[model samples]
Target: MRWSETCLSEQLGIDPGKELQQLYLRILRQDPALTLDPPVLATEPAAVKHNLPAQVTSFNGRDWEMIEVREMITEHRLVTLVGGGGVGKSRLAVEVAQNVLDDFPDGVWLVELPPLVQPGITAQSLAKALSLGEHPIVPLEEVIEDRLKRKKRS
Candidate 1:
């Protein structure tokens, strides 16, 4: 823990819970975040819900493309960016995902498909990407689908 977090926690009379709140935070992600200051925590437990990578480099141009992609994603549930490698497809996807993070209360999730070559294991790959390591007795796809279904109902 950072000195700022500890010092501020003590100064504000905060007593952290046993076993830590983070142990079950992914399920706790919802509307109206309740995280305390410093306004932005570097490794906040609420943030653990999303696996989206941070934007490292400065992004420029593609205003029209960004708008189109954003509109498509908003209007349609399944939006795929079809482009060749090195054509900024991934960047556009990340930008759109980041922009729409608040729209999905459950969490904004991204599955990197580059490492996957076999279609047969795509579900398994996605489960791995989601870090859903529940006992194999409960099918991962069922868990993933059930989660999305519940989100859709809300």
Candidate 2:
């Protein structure tokens, strides 16, 4: 079955522009077997070390919040830390991701999105972070998803 961007955006409850919709459509066209549900692979021992940065100073207080964040990470696949600039949201996210590194056998990756100027570049940014080269025919998101699926099966 073919899918359009408007249909997908309405189903996902997000308003994507014409360009994003075209990209999504292209991704769907390139990979006919893609689905909303990610494929599950057998669990295996982690082969790579996490890429978290070394702590420069001691983390003081926030023990309660830390515990809660850790629990949330364990329970949820996606977690967002919202706060103003310099409020340590990024630091907390890193700490939480680092703490749960063992939970993800494929290793936790930090895709810094600060340098991204447009929302359309997200797939490209993720692809670059994962060291996957771009393909002429396939969308970046498809390549990234394929790589992630391969990682799960490895």
Candidate 3:
């Protein structure tokens, strides 16, 4: 198969255009006056599992850092990027996550930590990002851990 086709089909395991088309059709049906509901996405493990937002800008040239981060993520279960503000950390992270989605069958999840989030709510924020809504009976840390553990490492 062609390289571009292989990336979309094998790595992402998605009909690249179908997802976007679905969103467009759903948006077209929404009533213009009413506030749109929060994303009602598929919850099944069988579904294409990614919550990555569309990239607004292009990633230009950072080949070395990309290679390093990708290798680290593959070797370690978790990798953190530290840098000053405006250092393109988020973009680089997102780009690397996109590249490595295939290595993770369950999904590659991105949890955002904005300054607005209160210090105490870090775990809750991650749970929300993963779309595991308030589970009153169970601790969120456990819930997040359970979800992450599902995909057996390659």
**Model number with the top TM-score:** 3
Candidate 1: tens digits of C-alpha lDDT, residues 23-141: 33533674245544566656746645467788999889998999998888667544667767789888888888888877777666676566446763767656676666656587777
lDDT (CA) per prediction? 0.68, 0.71, 0.76
Poorest 10 consecutive residues by lDDT, candidate 3: 15-24
lDDT of 2 by residue, 1-154 (tens): 1355466667886666777767667786876555467767779764665567878876777888899988886665445577677898778777777777767777777665564477867776677768899899988878888886655311
Candidate 1, backbone clash total: 0
Q: What stretches of model 2 exceed 4 Å from their correct place?
A: 1-47, 63-72, 75-82, 149-154
- Give the Å error, residue 80, model 2: 4.6
Candidate 3 contains a number of clashing pairs equal to 0
lDDT of 2: 0.71
Please give the RMSD to the true structure for each candidate, in Å: 15.4, 22.4, 20.3
Q: How good is model 2 by TM-score?
A: 0.54
Better model by TM-score: candidate 1 vs candidate 2: 1
lDDT of 1: 0.68
Query: What TM-score against the true fold does each predicted structure earn?
Result: 0.55, 0.54, 0.58
